[model samples]
Target: MPRRAMLRSAAVAGTAATLSLVPATASAAPNRWTPEELKDRKRVLEAGFTEAEADCWLLVVRATAAFFALPELHPLAKPEVVTAVHVIQDKLMMRPAYRKYRAANP
Candidate 1:
């Protein structure tokens, strides 16, 4: 197998091994995007993003904040996450205010 495949397999195995150690119950629930967060979604439009764009921005903002705080998620993705946030910010800022206004109106 290629090195990337090997690493992925190892990572999968590590995850499985880690998971098996945990005592789980059927009462455990998966994370769900709450109605509160959905209502909070429009707050991003204030910063000049389309509805779809705002949702994407919110996803990255929430995910990175949660991801970096969890040591279990490895530190390697930090730089990429920061770069993605910065790229989105710069892309939005470079657009004409009219463009942002149009996006906001819809």
Candidate 2:
């Protein structure tokens, strides 16, 4: 095969593989505002996130724990769970590199 044709084939194959790894639909996380989340509001505020984001983060943590408790009925792949996990991951990823390094080193 010609070099150009071979490169084009590889690019197409890589693109297809990348597309296959992406989810078909993006689902929104459920709105679950509860008074319980308020207790940690101050801490969250100090950590640079709004009360609302903190509440959602707690909810996601709760949901993830629940899923872990009962894996059969509460699959991690469920839309809400998946959204929660993604949200938590995004939040953690947004943290400063120094903080992450310190946490890892500590």
Candidate 3:
């Protein structure tokens, strides 16, 4: 896998492990990955994406999921929410998490 992919995977695994402690109904508005996201992932993979590319796509999808998980989002404009979500997502899915995930998964 690409360096970025490894890092991203680590972050995802770490974040997921942490989040797993929370119940599905932990929040009234739990972020759910919709069926459309599954379809989109499949589409990306079928288009002959490299592993890193697919992981990048996963980051986007996961970020959207995280965005929905935020309770303060409803008060913001759509564009603002999008910007905030992406920014936060980037932070959460960076090298530190990636390293942790890679160590455990490997």
| TM-score of every candidate | 0.41, 0.36, 0.36
Q: Where's the lowest-lDDT run of ten residues in candidate 2?
A: 22-31
lDDT of 1 by residue, 1-106 (tens): 9854565556445533543443252113113346766565556566566655555445555655775787656554555555555655555545547686788998
Off by over 4 Å in 2: 1-40, 71-87, 92-106
| Candidate 1 runs further than 4 Å off | 1-40, 72-80, 93-106
RMSD of each: 10.9, 12.6, 11.6
- Cα lDDT of candidate 3 equals 0.54
Worst 10 residues of 3 by lDDT: 24-33
lDDT of 3 at 76: 37
Leading candidate by lDDT: 3
User: What C-alpha lDDT do the candidate models reach, one value each?
Assistant: 0.53, 0.51, 0.54
The whole-model C-alpha lDDT of candidate 1 against the native structure comes to 0.53
Q: Alpha carbon lDDT of residue 50, candidate 1? A: 66
Residue range 23-86, candidate 2, lDDT tens digits: 2321122233345555554566577664445544565556466665774653424554455466
Q: Which scores better on TM-score, 1 or 3?
A: 1
* Better structure of 1 and 2 per lDDT: 1
